[model samples]
Target: MKKFMLITCFIIGGFATAQAQQTSPVWPGCEDAEDVKACFNQKLAQHVRKNYEYPQSEDGEYIRGKVKISFTITEEGKAVVESVEGDKAEVNAAAKAMIQKIPDMEPGTLNGEPDDRNFTVPFNF
Candidate 1:
């Protein structure tokens, strides 16, 4: 009986931990949003399209790359760059710029508690 209880507790604890980690930022363009996400997505897309000025390369420089960056938003609603994957130089620079300039994203919530959240970005230049 004691062993059964211990195993059950472990399972429950593991489940809780997984749930906690599952918490993530509300995507900037979720369809369920009333208007906020749409507004931000539209504005952000414009900002990225305009701001990312790829350096000229001899091969008619073009960045056809996609970067997935995980970021966090502070409790006060600020985007923070976390990790970036893709072209080391350009992707990192673009990711940093996106976080710095993209307007605040609505912070994500978990278990009904508002908290900093993890999110991703994809860039194609």
Candidate 2:
């Protein structure tokens, strides 16, 4: 019984230590997001400009809409899309396409360690 208790205690301690070490990605709004928004916006814009797909509307006019793409930021500042939200079909496609085109970001940091963070990117055509 005593041996079992000691082993359990050690296991619990190990888990606690590991959990304490885990960190969350810190965004600009998350941590310094306000400071980083400009950088984020710039990067996002560059991505859109490079990847923008101007599909024609049913009326032969160009169609453009805003879409919000939500993604996770890795500890190394890479943005990984979790999901997207919007109405226009093309906008949704653009959101996914643009997200795929996003270069790995400088991962967000928390407690000096890389962490997962979520960010919303708005794509307007």
Q: List the candidates' TM-scores in order.
A: 0.55, 0.60
Give me the candidate number with maximum TM-score: 2
- Candidate 2 lDDT: 0.69
lDDT of 2 by residue, 1-125 (tens): 99999999999999877765444443343345554656566656766788877777889887777777888777666666788887788778767877776666556555567767777767667
RMSD of each: 5.0, 6.3
C-alpha root-mean-square deviation, candidate 2: 6.3
Q: Over 4 Å off in model 2, which ranges? A: 1-37, 58-60
The residue pairs that clash in candidate 2, if any, are 28-32, 28-33, 29-33, 75-114, 75-115, 76-107, 77-105, 77-106, 77-107, 77-108
What TM-score does structure 1 among the candidates reach?
Answer: 0.55
- Per-model tally of clashing residue pairs: 1, 10
Name the regions of candidate 1 deviating beyond 4 angstroms: 1-33, 58-64, 105-113
